[model samples]
Target: MSQTNIPLLSLKNISKQFFGSTVLENINFDLYPGEVHAIFGQNGAGKSTLIQIVTGDIQPSSGKIILNNEELKIHSVHKARELGISAVFQEFSLVPQLTVEENLFLGSNNTKGFFLDKKKLHQMACQTMEQLEFSIKPEEKIINLSHAEKRMVEIAKAFHTKPSIMVLDEPTASLAENETNQLFSMIEILKKEGIGVIYITHRMKEIYKISNRITILQDGHVVNTDSVSNINEQKLVELATGRNITNLFPEIKKQRGKKLLDIKNLHISNSFIEDVSINVKAGEVIGITGLAGSGKSAIGRACFGVNKIEAGTISYLDDVIFDSSKQINDISPRAMLDRGMLYLPSDRRAEGLIMEQNIRENISLPSLGLPKFSNGFIVNRKIEKDIVEKIGE
Candidate 1:
């Protein structure tokens, strides 16, 4: 290769292990200037582990990370940022209580003086958001912003660093189509500025549209790495999953059981879900989709009792769970869960799991008070362990 062909960053024989189990093995990858290199894989295929190692969130068991032809011993996230590497992970890192401007410069050296220069910081944040064409107020609290807005803020924070290497892990997972397009445009701008981008996503269309090269990981190993033009979508999926994906989508079965949930003239005043009526069958897999502010999420939240219904009625089988006419409060989340209703929030870190807790503890937390896992007060260790194991399997 010529001097101009040298990779901006290269991973040489990278491998990672947790406890005694291997998570990544001898993974060799290259990210060249002005190109998008995508890492594609199924869940647990080590894509996240690889990115974490590069970002200095986790240490690799073996291998070297070379940036600008110099070997780097990345020990912490701050060190990686100092080395001109920035990343926007799948999970949002913004503090919910903080304003957009605060979150943008949270740990950055941009904040000067004993007290934060709020005026200057706000101006800088507005400029950054404008550059990305994101229409969000810098003074708005992160908790009040929509999921897509938060994702844009995360991207803005990473872009503000002006890094030579930018890593985006599933950046568009929560974004609407227009927001995704905006992000793609920003990536193009970064490429024009000679920034090497590492895009980790499972979306095949994205790889074909924006990536220069594609690297597939399977079972902790690099299955293949090739130019996007050299491989088709089916081949890429096969490589990631380690099996032939004959159908891009599974066949849609029309069979549906009795109506399990019925919402009639539902109106959630706070969320703007107005007079929406929906029926869900027992065996149906329903998809509710719309633009960013279209009240799709509110429906799910109201159904699961997270958002209160202002009017209308919600019936589950023979029972009227919620009826605004009767002025009854919505059923609690615990009551819904007991009745086999589960809600997987989009913000998994805040709503789903306890980051400080281990996997076993997080998994067993909701079931601790159940009779099967506990004897009214004391938890049966064996039962809890078995439940966790079963759920993991």
Candidate 2:
């Protein structure tokens, strides 16, 4: 079939429930060939669940999936990939210990009869990387690759088989400015090749720049599906949040307060970062913009006590002090939370949210020590539900 004759993939009234709690209700969606389809929503708006169902990682409770006119019994991820559906989820699936080529062809090692063809695998990975215009060495271990390089490898792997459809979930979340441009160029190449792309991103600029159509989900339901040319970024954000958000990043007046943290000198390994110094003020949001592995997250980690700095004097509040000599356990993530300092990690799937845990458990993870719960030792499930509903708002 030609790219425009029929939708490469379609979902019809797909509804799913976990323990009788409806997660997706009457969800109807479609992805046409050679088009960049964008899905947007707030957290817990069923975007991830719908992606899982489309990728066959989980089956829908009801409704059918049609891929090229074939009804899909999406029971396993293997079957989904075989049917030309590939997803690069927010939580990267790359194995750091393995080389780039090995990670690319980790499974389903295409063989010459009965033996694994290692040479062919390397050749295939190189060809895929070339298609994406990446210059990564095939023999380099994933651990040695920069965060941006790792993300590039993930994209190259997605195109390894030259699948008809590609689903990217926040693929550029950790990327830098130049890397994002390169990735966009690659996405454009894919679209030109008549491959359907489902791009999920929180950034408004990406939607405007790449997508041909936009689909908004609000409170686990489809809110709008319209051509990108028909809707602007302001309207799309309104549809996703169910409110007229004047500014996604609310402006706040800067008040010169006491230095909350002062870092004298800092250095990191693997050439991912170099000598860096900064002092953050109380109630000030210091924006750090850089490519992947430019030490934005590393600096956050060193400040939060997760990473070990080679040399640095971290002074806090002009009184409290934290030096490089301190152990990793000294500034526990929970302790930081208790000290009115909390880290909202970038990896929402792996670091922020627990997929296996239900809504209640995930939401109540950080505030379990409140005195409202049975001497603060036991959880009051009722209070927890109220907290989730509040935060989810």
Candidate 3:
């Protein structure tokens, strides 16, 4: 094949609208074989919308999608998969109750007769796991797997399709550094096999490391597309945000105050945390770093009332929030929030926000029952709108 040949996948003049509002406009993108094409943008920059159109989850209002120089009319996800396109979205679609093998071949049409060939399925699943360097067992249930393990299974499932074009949206958001390296290695193997990978991520470092070409999107339009070497990180950020980001991280010089939170001899039953002690001062920032299964996240959960503290003393600014020595009931999450202690869960979609609710509803959820936003049991529309707008700002 010549370098001047048709692209493996070409999106020409793609535009999408929702309820008369343009979400994507005249977007032209291409994915070439054996190359990793990265799509970069800020939040609501139409990155997900563009990906949905490609995966047949949403149809574009105007444009043509060419696959191997032929215009393709992708009506559904099944059709896209059948036409050698596969995607591993950020939110995994695995059935938690199903085994790894079952989830891997759940929607596949490769079985013979009415009965499922367990032996064949196991063999194929094992082969795919081996190819992707995944370490989970085929018989393991997804519910019992860790976040990183589930992410690996999702990737393995997508790779098992043997698609010529692959789309990975924020694949490493939940993965650790070592796990991310493993995924990058797998991407290299795919590239060698002439698979065109469309990688979407907000991390700037990964783009330079894994992508051959970069496409920046701003306000539902393609700002620029160029070779990785042709654009520096600063220039790339500027293009995506449409502004000169001179200092991405400004210097902070603030004096610390008295201890605000004090955790003493903390222990979570049947978990990794044991006899841990920590203190946080007001106006101070702290970071927790450890291996994937470490008790770092557990500490946050315990402090936020998500995990029970079997033995500990949690004092907030001289006030005893939780004292395991006392025979009292555990504090609820609502109580902690009412005390002005909010915990932002790592899994935003599942715990932090309601996915089905709109932005206004999500923002007002915490204060729904408050007197300022609700009269008796009815919500004050003006107050709710004002609260959302203030929080959004």
lDDT of each: 0.88, 0.83, 0.89
Winner by TM-score: 1
Query: How good is model 3 by TM-score?
Result: 0.91
Ranking by lDDT: 3, 1, 2
Name the 10 consecutive residues with the lowest summed lDDT in model 2: 320-329
Model with the higher lDDT, candidate 1 or 2 = 1
* lDDT per residue (tens digit) for residues 1-393 in model 3: 116466999999999999999999999999999889999999999999999999999899999999989998899998999889999998879999999999999977667698788899999999998887778999999999988888888888888889989999999986889988988998988888788999999999999999999999999999999999999988998999999989877788999999988989999866899999999999998888877778788898888888878998888778887887885544678777787888888878888898898989888898877899888778898989987898789
The runs of at least 3 residues in candidate 3 whose Cα sits more than 4 Å from the true structure, single-residue gaps closed, are: 1-4, 326-330, 353-361, 372-393
Write down the RMSD of all candidates, one decimal each: 2.6, 4.3, 2.6
Assess the local accuracy of residue 21 in candidate 1 as a C-alpha lDDT between 0 and 100.
Answer: 95
Give Cα distance to truth, residue 1, candidate 3, Å: 12
List, residue by residue over 1-393, the lDDT tens digit for candidate 2. Answer: 134768999999999999999999999999988989999999999999999998888999999899998776878888888898888876778998999998888877588889878899888888888877898999899989876788888888888877899999998877788888988999999988888999998888898899988889998899999888888777877888788978866867877788887777776544365668888987787887776656678877766766766765766666445566663224557766777777887767767898998988977888887676435667788888887888889
**Clashing residue pairs in candidate 1 (N, C-alpha, C atoms within 3 angstroms):** none
The candidate that wins on lDDT is: 3
Question: For residues 58-162, what per-residue lDDT tens digits would candidate 1 score against the true structure?
Answer: 999999999999998899998999898999998888999999999999976664667788889999999998877778999999999987888888888888888
Give every collision pair in model 2. Answer: 176-291
